[model samples]
Target: MWQIILKRENEISLSRQLFYAMKDMILEGQIRSGEALPSSRGLAKDMSISRSTVNEAYDMLETEGYIVTHQGAPTRVKEGLYLEKHQKHHEEALFPVITLADKPYKVDFKTGQPDVSLFPRYVWNQMMYKSFEQLSDKDLGYFGTAGYESLRVEISHWLFRKRGLSAKPQDIFITSGTTQALSILVTMLSKAGLPFAVEDPCHRGLLEVIENSGNSILGISVDQEGMKTALLEAHDFSAVYVTPSHQFPLGSILTAERRIELIRLARQKKFYIIEDDYDSEFRYVGASVTPLYSMDKEQVLYTGSFSKTLYPALRIGFVILPPKLHSEWMYLRKHLDVQNPIVEQAALAEFLNQRKLDKYIQQISRMYEKKRKALTTSIYECFGEQCSILGDETGLHLVLKIPGAHFDEFFIEKCQNAGIRVFPIEHYCISKGNHMDQLMLGYGHLKVEEIQKSVSRLYNLIMDTE
Candidate 1:
């Protein structure tokens, strides 16, 4: 007699369950090779199930090579189906739990993160709903890699109005984010084994993108005036990447003179300049700085992302390419994930067309500016004049420099143990030993009270270490 148990109460189809049970028995050697299985009619009668259900299970077993069946012939177990049971490995259970603290960190100064809670959910939901309703059948299909045409057009218009830059819709290519845009640009522009020049204390993630492409990177140091353009002439470069509007960690605007000098060098050396205009939308100071792409469109690959402006989950960003590079860009983009999803793109296009994004940016900028002030005020109050703040004029984070204080891994780890999280400027440096006295603190996502308390905690931690 067969020992097959059926679970009629289970939600799974009877055929599937029977199939799994039979397959397991075959693998476990309970059902020997070449052994004939029970007839479909007899098994159905014995189990009180339909003959078709038993037939379906047998069909699946035969299809998977667990059993073999032929016209008017017995269904026999396939040969060599047995497999040894794997022993359970519980090695991970032997490890001790190392607790930093009982509770979560008092503060986390994570950079490049915006306050997503303040986003207009209702309005955005409305845009998404409308987009879903209005999208033609063709829109839901594989749209072009160049991106939603209407969204591109709206982005072009918004750029002119917001940043005073002129970009054509045809030349704009949508990407998942600035990260993806940078990765593709690095791969495309890397030439003949020539290195890509980048700011020394650059965004580590962006640096990795260039490094992963198998191209050498030339780390040009940055200062209070941004990347040292004078050092760029020492070697031949395929392309140069710079954050011109507001530098990443140090937060310095690329002065007009330095911008011109960099462009001149690129022209003379026949290299392209990748201008990453990330997080310039929330500038709390004077009018936003002019992008380098506006200066020389032919040689500058301008990239921007809405992750900081809107929400990080939006995953919508763009790069402005010259006519010569458009074909290659499409070819590369096609190979990399084919294209981003269509619903989000359509919703974003509608959102841009209605100027909802402009309104949201205006609303959030005021709040972020206030948060920035709270952070600066707290830093000044905590360490007084001993700690000076840098790059507070714009962006969600600022550099806090303590003249004699060295912020390293040990200091950061100690702070983390005390339930506080802060990053060192040196963490982002390509060449170590520089920016040892500076710590990077992001405040755009923190409340005023949290900023004050976190700064106080940070102050105590620093004093205790000293």
Candidate 2:
């Protein structure tokens, strides 16, 4: 009789439970190495289950090298199958429960995240449901390495209409998100043998991504106009990253003259520009500012994402590669993720085709614009002449500069105690000792009332620090 008992009502699948039970026995040496396992037919009869179910359990063990079998012979536990048991460390649990937000902050001005509650989930669900209703054999199989071609075409048109950038569908490739696209590009662009020139006080998460790839990052100073291209004429670099549409932390648009200057520098120095046009859709001002990719397609690798606009979990973004790099990008992407899931791509394509995305962006822009006003007005009321706001022209966040105030970790700790969580601009600086007096406040996800309350709390924190 089989030693293991099956649970029919458990949430875990039967085959997986069976496999785990056998694996535990093997590792504990209760099932001795070289001992033959009961035949599938015998075990199935003992357990009152189908032979196929028993065979599946054996197949998993065999595939994992836990057991061995020869032609026309019974399966036996592999030698050295026993593993020494170690006491479980609570922190080392396979799925340890980590607290994402332990502190009950009254308001968190976290940047680069949108209020997704307003997204039209009903419409999106309908589109996704339709994709499954008409699912095809090819769609469920290896559709292609590049991406869903129709989605690519739709993205190409969307970019053209939204940002005035014309790109062929063949050159567009889908990725998991903006980070993946930039990560892949890091590998491809590293061959040029020069450090990546990035903005000095740029996105810290992005800097971590570049550092993880073992690439050197050279800091380019950013002014009110954005990535100071004039700083690049002296030093050589393989590539430069800019948040041109609305700069990252600083939230300044790259000026037209500087945009042209960047293109000229890249051409003259033989470098590439990595434009992260993230959150451009929510610009509170004029139509989304034109991207650098529009100035020169061949030199710029453009990245855009649907995470902020639709929802962060969508994990869908695209990159427009030049014709020359298409082959390498395709090979690398195929090996990395294969391709993005088709169901969402199809759903997003339908989302774009029906002009729902355009309407969604329009509505959210107005909502965020009002939140931005509330935030600035609150800052003025609280600190009056003590504080100044920058980069309010666009983006979900703005820079609040408090002159003569050096905000540091101590200041942040005080804010935490007061039930406020806001980030100082110095945290994002690659070169420190600068921007210690400034803080970045994101208002897009905060309600009008929350913004008003958070700013007042922030003012008190600043006052206490001084």
Best by TM-score: 1
Model 1, residue 288: C-alpha shift (Å): 0.9
Per residue, candidate 1 scores C-alpha lDDT tens digits across 215-307 of 888899999899999998789988999998889889999988899999999889888999999988888888888898999999999999889
Q: State model 2's lDDT.
A: 0.87
**Clash tally for model 2:** 0
- Candidate 2 residue-wise lDDT at 379: 90
TM-score of 2: 0.86
Residue 196 displacement (Å), model 1: 1.8
lDDT of 1: 0.90
Give candidate 1 misplaced runs (Cα > 4 Å). 1-7, 27-30, 41-51, 80-103
Give the C-alpha miss distance for residue 272 in model 1, angstroms: 1.0
Q: Please write out the lDDT profile of model 2 over residues 333-389, one tens digit for every residue.
A: 888979888899889988998889989988898889889889889999999987799
- Superposed Cα deviation of residue 289, candidate 2 (Å): 1.9
